[model samples]
Target chain A: MSQLKRVQQWATFARVWHIYDAAWQNPFQSAELLKKYLMGMHKPIYHPMNDCGDHVIVINTADVALPGDEWKKRVYFHHTGYPGGASWTLAWELHKKNPTMVMKKAVYNSMDRSLQRRYTMERLHLYPDANVPLNLLENVSNQIKQLRPKPKRLDEYKEEEVREFPKLIDLPKSYIVE
Target chain B: MVFTSVVNYVRARGPDEIWRKRRIFKLAAHFIGRRRNCYSIALRNVHRALAYATKGRKLKRADMANLWETRVRAGCEQHNISYETFREGLARTDILLNRKTLADLACWEPYSFKALTDIAKRRALDDGLAGIKADTSIDRIITRGTLHRDK
Candidate 1:
């Protein structure tokens, strides 16, 4: 191959690093999105036997949002291989113990049960907050957009902006101040 | 040469026997143990391997087609468009590009693929196709269908 063609080949096979902000994003939905990058399904050269997967750096996993009451309702099961050693941990409880565990498990379960699952998981780096190592952060050239927009909290709005908001009815002068 | 007795005739083997066994042996040359050297075992393994090869040919095509679709879908996702919508938009606009070619463009010529997606997005929005977000701005795009309608 010519020098240009060889370089093109290398570019095509090169593994890319992507960064994702998991704050207020659904872990389950994010997992489905991240799984594509982790398994290299986003690449044209992807194959079951080929190692074309990319690295994904997820930050702010502790702030991930679960729809409805999943945080209280979802249960993670584990067994110690001994009789009566089974345990079930609620999603909220697990998150409190390890902030990144919920997001990590979500991505882990999203992928197919294959021999490469562990190796693929190794490429995923999750941080409880946006404090990633400088080395890893520098490697990220792309950003995976969140599945849904992060909802703005009422507290996040400035007092001036909130006070000027339109109202359908004027408050009565006799209305008691809480 | 005619055999003098019925027993001699029964014992005589055809000259093609060696060639027939050699063909099976040739296919089983890569096989291990008795399966490679023993004619009976080699023949059975060789037949199975040939059957797999015949089936594998069709499977390879299907696998490639699936891979192309995956690549194209991934490309579409990057631009915030669904694969079905992208294909539908392109079809409606008469782009006529196949999955293999679209996949090749997506991997090799990313800019070209992006342009294709932009065109598809415009076409999809113009037609108000389902599944489209309707958030994309199509002010600058001018498709053949749009030109005909404008005139």
Candidate 2:
């Protein structure tokens, strides 16, 4: 056998995807999902030193919800150099002030702190509502799965689907409408 | 309530006189030049600045994109993979990583980048015969999520 080692060719690249904000799910979890994209951890080409993450465009920031009392209890603090400059802004209060900042911060802080964090942040585009410009929306190629299932509206069920459901028992003629 | 033409009191927007008259000047405030203060010059200056802003944005995007492509290309070179081969392999494998993110990974995460190169190399070899068709854009190129045999 020859002493020389095999030298194969070809390089790998990262994949990016988009995420949308829905009121029903956890933004924190979604932030990690964003991080996964940014780090390119989801792909076989992912390396710890590589920034193979994808762009995440989030919309509907106005409707993002926090569990239980995070809205009231959570506080973002800021201090100016002047006396009594220290002040606190609650989560909901901050959200009211700038709807996009809440999810943006969550996604930002979720990643491992490094110089590239800001670069990853640049790829994250947040919008307050569903009214995204056509140009921006057109670039989105994929989506991350949501933690919570979207609840279906009553009227969303098709007539055929309702009819197809097997009935366990038939109501007697004396059945009264509740 | 009766209106008169003489000595009309304009409801000043704020306490500062300069600020009150800053309707057109506010547009020039962002510009760093003597023209920002000079009213006649500021008028034309603001118009020019607004026009340039649109063009500047497009140029800036192109500039950054070029830099990112350069970075990704350099990263591929380091791993002994040609940029063309790497890009083609990735596209065939359905990996849609944009240049910015790829360059980022190239700079910050060398090991991850190496792993990516390794995969691309393997996939490139399997490129011709194994035409594994997956429709979704988010389909995992590496993971053999589905099993099918040639009939």
Candidate 3:
């Protein structure tokens, strides 16, 4: 190939490093989004036989939100291949044991059952917090936008902004505060 | 050449049977075992292979188109633009590039593709295309279509 063609080839097949903040994001929903990048489905050159998958670094996995009461209602099942070895762990319990496991398993289970699943999983880097290794952080050139905007807590608002906010009706001084 | 009798005509095949079988065998040359060496088996496999080849030709084109659409969509998503919005915007701006070319630009000529997306974004915003919300980031992109429009 000519020099320009060779460079184009490299550019097309280049492995992009994407960073996703899992804070307040549902793991299942995030997994579907992350799967696209992990498998390089976003790329035009993506093929099942082509190793064009990108590296995805997911941060704040510990803070990943489960929709509604999923943290308590959802269960992860596992079997040890012996009698009475099967076990079920609640989502919250599993998350407490390993903060990254929920997000990891979500992405794992979201993919199709194929021999390439394990290899593709290898490219995913999950962190419980934002403290990623410098080398890995340095490689992240793109950020995957959160599916839903992160909800801000009342405490997160500035005092001035909160105080200046419009009120439909002011509470009486006699009213007891919760 | 006229056959003297019906028996002679039956004995005389139209063409060389060996050469006819050779054509089928040639197609199945890569097949393993009896399929490659045996004429009847080779013929059956060759016919099936040709049918698949014909179907695969159409499938290949469709697959490539799908791949190009995927690549172009990826590029659009990277720029925070939906594929439909991008295409609509491009179409409105009179940029008639096809998916394959757009896909090529997305992969090999990223800067050009980015420029195209910028134009598309501006057009989409101006036209108030669905799924394209106004954003301050693309406000600075000035396209010819917007040049004459009231702000």
Clashes of each: 0, 13, 1
Listed for each candidate, the true contacts retained, as a fraction, are: 0.70, 0.00, 0.67
Q: Which stretches of candidate 3 lie over 4 Å from their true place?
A: A1-14, A41-50, A68-98, A112-115, A130-135, A154-178, B1-17, B39-41, B133-148
- Every model's DockQ, to 2 decimals? 0.52, 0.02, 0.46
Candidate 1: interface RMSD equals 1.6
Question: Model 1: per-residue lDDT, tens digit, B7-90?
Answer: 887877766898989988989999999999999989989989999999999999999899889989878887888999999999
Across residues A71-103, which tens digit of lDDT does each residue of candidate 1 receive?
999999999999999999999999999999999
Q: Which TM-score value belongs to model 2?
A: 0.45
What C-alpha RMSD separates each model from the true structure?
4.9, 22.3, 5.0
In angstroms, how far off is B137's CA in candidate 3?
7.9
lDDT of 2: 0.72
Give the winner by DockQ: 2 or 3.
3
Candidate 3 residue-wise lDDT, A1-178, digit = tens = 9999999778877899999999999899999999999999887566777899999999999999999999999999999999999999999999999999999999999999999999999999999999999999999999999998999999999999999999898888889577
Q: How close to the true structure is residue A58 of candidate 1, measured as C-alpha lDDT?
A: 96
Residue pairs with backbone overlap in model 3: A44-B71
Which ranges of candidate 1 are over 4 A from the true structure? A1-11, A82-86, A170-178, B1-27, B32-58, B78-81, B109-115, B130-142
Q: What's model 2's lDDT at B2?
A: 59
Candidate 1: pairs in clash: none
Q: Count clashing residue pairs in model 2.
A: 13
Q: Is candidate 2 or candidate 3 better by TM-score?
A: 3
Error of 3 at A128 (Å): 3.3
